[model samples]
Target: MESAAAQVGCLRRTSLSVSDVEGRHREMIVGDRSTWSFRVHYHSGDEIVHMLAGRAMLRIGQSARRVEAGETVVVPAGVVHRFEALDQLGWGFVSEFVAPGAEGPGPAKTESSLIAGVRAMLEDRYSLRTDVAQIADACAMSKGYLSRRFRQESGISLHDFHMLIALHNAKSMLKGGSSIVEAALDAGFYDQAHLTREFVRTYGFTPGVFRAAWQSAPRLPSLTHH
Candidate 1:
């Protein structure tokens, strides 16, 4: 993993797209005065935007709100929202637009070492099955103990976290032009209908509609880290 300073430096030079943290979900690190001005006219999935640094302004329909560091806002599916930088703000932002569930606070600092190990496992191998027993083993704790502690720290069950990861992957594939059936299989969904049902329920529109809107939009220039 890159050092925080290195990550910041990369952002300062240009906008960078990090590896997806979950399925179609991506985290964008935008540097000072790097402005993003585009309207998200249609939404296929809910988006949870967390401000990791500086400040940002979010416009939803007619109303606008400023979000500062350490704050977060959930943009529900189908809402017309746009984001703009506030001043020469550098921001580390996480955008999860594939899942319908909510995330509580992340794991505590005390569990950083363990969380790192788990993250490594997930990043290194997409085939690794995530279960309470497996995660507990990675943390070197009993299943029951890990379950309770993880819930206390993250405010959600371990299973739910894995589900979020799966959903995120599915969304990314969809956005990349993969068929619904293919994305569903790739994301571990039972079938295309299962994926479609959950996706529509969380995002307020069918997958077909979302895909059409996304494909019709103007493509922004590719952003990369130096």
Candidate 2:
């Protein structure tokens, strides 16, 4: 697969990039302890975000959504939206972009079982096997079919979804003062560079930068409310 930068460039050239932000992308921004707010003006491409931590309100078009830890939402392209982190809960979001292509339309609503299973794997690291084929089998589907369905249901390929989960876990470890190499191993990545590559792709910053930002920020109350 092409690097995230290359993919972003492709989306930009195709006029599929979000206006303020250029290109199809995935990212996580660790907000400060205080509430952080910004208007999201997206021109093209769709977005699916899974909130891993904190509480936030998402304004999509004229509708407002309250999102808490473990909640997910979809923002269609061209919709004016904004997100604000409420209270002390520092937010972690996993986002993916969908460009126009053979992929067809945006992500379809996925079955609760599938979403629950995927979320479980992400949270309970022990339950997840690193092997793609094994995961597909566990889902009771062929690899190719699982990939297609995952893309259709999640607006991202199965591999990208798994990588995002791994990245999220790696970030948590790194923020907790783990070394990059150790974080990579704990997150199921092969090596530091491999984690770095995915980290940059998802967050537009290196893991070191992300870790520093997270560590220096004031601590938020734990997200025990769910």
CA shift at 38, candidate 2, in angstroms? 18
The digit string of per-residue lDDT tens for model 1 on 1-226 reads 1235533543354342324333333333333333434323323345677777777788764578998878988876534456777766444465544422244112223345554465455534353256667667767899989877755544445565555555556766766677878877788777777766665444333455444444453343442110
How many collisions per candidate?
A: 4, 0
lDDT of 1: 0.53
Task: Tell me the tens digit of each residue's lDDT in model 2 across 1-226.
Answer: 2356744542332211111123322223332233445424332345677777778888653567788878888776534456777766456566555343434222223334675475455555632254658667788888788767655544445555566567656765765778888888888887777877666554445676655545554443331000
Among all windows of ten consecutive residues in candidate 2, which has the lowest summed lDDT? 13-22
Instruction: Find the 10 residues in a row with the least total lDDT in model 1.
Output: 217-226
